[model samples]
Target: MAEKFTDEEFAFLRYARFGSLPERVKLEELVALNETEPAPDYSDLAYDAKERAEG
Candidate 1:
């Protein structure tokens, strides 16, 4: 089994990984980014191994 990290260790890990962003992103910008992309079409995609093997 793996050992659990303490609160101090977890804080240190988060700081080391992400540090701090120079500027905060606006909520509007985030919403616009998501809206800009169209959802993908998976209508013709195979859902099983048998279908994949046949094709």
Candidate 2:
């Protein structure tokens, strides 16, 4: 059986995991950064999946 965390313990766990992350970003800057990234290529992933299924 899994042990359950109390609210305080859960809050501590959440902070422990993400406390060091940057907590703020301008929406416009984030959008501009996102626009500069190219779309992901999944052709090789599809081919790998097809091979696994056929094998």
Candidate 3:
């Protein structure tokens, strides 16, 4: 846990967090999937109300 980990220390850190030799991309995907984005564009929701208003 020095200011900068040595090569061995860095390798150990990565393995500890991700298990042995895990794919970096898979880790990124997992983290991304767990993240919450905005409510997404729902301004176009359709319902019978719009039809009733039109007719």
TM-score of each: 0.35, 0.35, 0.36
How far is 6's C-alpha from truth in model 3 (Å)?
0.9
Candidate 2: lDDT over CA atoms?
0.81
Rank the candidate models, highest TM-score first: 3, 2, 1
Candidate of highest lDDT: 2
Write candidate 2's Cα lDDT for 1-55 as tens digits. 9999999998899889888557588876675333466755799788889999999
For 1-55, candidate 3 gives per-residue lDDT tens digits of: 6497799998899988988874467554664346577664555445555777899
Sort by lDDT, best first.
2, 1, 3
Q: Local distance difference test, per candidate? A: 0.73, 0.81, 0.70
lDDT of 3 at 13: 92
Summarize candidate 1's per-residue lDDT along 1-55 as a digit string, tens digits.
9999999998899889999556887777775333466644565343455587988
Worst 10 residues of 2 by lDDT: 31-40
Q: Deviation in angstroms for 27 in model 3?
A: 19
Candidate 3 Cα outliers beyond 4 Å, as residue runs? 23-41, 46-49, 52-55
- How big is the positional error of residue 20 in model 1, measured in Å on the Cα after superposition? 3.2
